[model samples]
Target: MIETIVFDVGETITRDDRYWASWADWLDIPRHTLSALVGAVVAQGRDNADALRLARPGIDVAAEYHAREAAGRGEHLDESDLYDDVRPALSSLRDLGTRVIIAGNQTSRAGELLRGLDLPADLVVTSGEWGVAKPQPEFFQRVLEVAQAAPRRTLYVGDHPVNDTFPAKAAGLRTAHIRRGPWGHLWADDPKVMEASDWRIDSLTQLTTLIEG
Candidate 1:
């Protein structure tokens, strides 16, 4: 039985529309342009942030993020940004006595905002808060530590094949590939992703059935 279900933040629990749109506005580029660039980078197995670099050559994304904050434009999250299924699915899992955790490659500020939403989760954390990011063995190690469960009993659900399914499987956690986000759809049929995932789900609601079954 799966005692713990850990989730990826972006494109898993929340929609990333605002995130990319915000960046497009910040860089004064068309939203479609940035979106295409992001998709291109993902297809090439490059960091999605490379889209920003492609938009404005030599632009330091880290420094620009600070500048945006200084100018009163920063990461923003609210209930509307969440996926429609997020609340019902997560709440249902918790109601079933499963441990629910939200962990992903997000900023510490994102972590704070997520916690503020008061979702029915046992813990919500981010790579920025933990000083490590996904695809790193250390990140999954920290996940295992926080979950306090045997790897085989903990399930990691995410959309990104490279960062989510592959690494979590390597860490011994059962992996579920959710077919939601762009990366999710783009690689859903890829051989490696199929090989790594123990389950393929279309929505968070499917998790409830998986756990109960």
Candidate 2:
């Protein structure tokens, strides 16, 4: 039986539309333009971190990210910031005596943001705090270690094919691909990636039934 449920934060539990749209406004660029650049970068198999550098000439991307992180501190994610199905699924999962965790590739301030939202997770882990990012086996190893979970009994839910589902499954954990995020939607019809996931859902609410069923 699955004892632990590990989740990807961005586009999985929380929607990043407002965050990225705010970034576009800060950069004085059209939101759609920024979105397209990010999508293009990902389409070419590049990291979203590379988008700013590729789109803007002579800008210090690392510093800019740090600045954004600093500015984003103490900011709370409102109910509208999360998907409609998130809270219900999380609550149901927790009530089932399952250990639910939110782990993702986010900045050091991720824990604070998660706390601000009052998510129904037992733990929150981020790449910045762990000093390693996802798709790297070490990160997933840390996740398992922190959760005190055996790989076989753990379930990882995320939208990333290469980053989230692929690696987690390879690590001996089951994976659920949520077809809502950029990576998920972009590779939705790709049999190679989609076939790797143990399960797939269009909405978070479906997770409850998936777990119960």
Residue 6 of model 2, lDDT score: 94
* Model 1 TM-score on a 0 to 1 scale: 0.99
Q: Could you give candidate 2's per-residue lDDT for residues 83-112 as a string of tens digits? A: 888889999999888899998998777667
Residue-by-residue lDDT tens digits, candidate 1, 15-105: 9999999999999999999999999998898889999999999999999999998998999999999999999999999999999999999
Worst 10 residues of 2 by lDDT: 68-77
Local accuracy by lDDT, each model = 0.95, 0.83
Which residue pairs in model 2 clash with each other?
none
RMSD (CA, angstroms), candidate 1? 0.6
Q: Number of backbone collisions per candidate, in order?
A: 0, 0
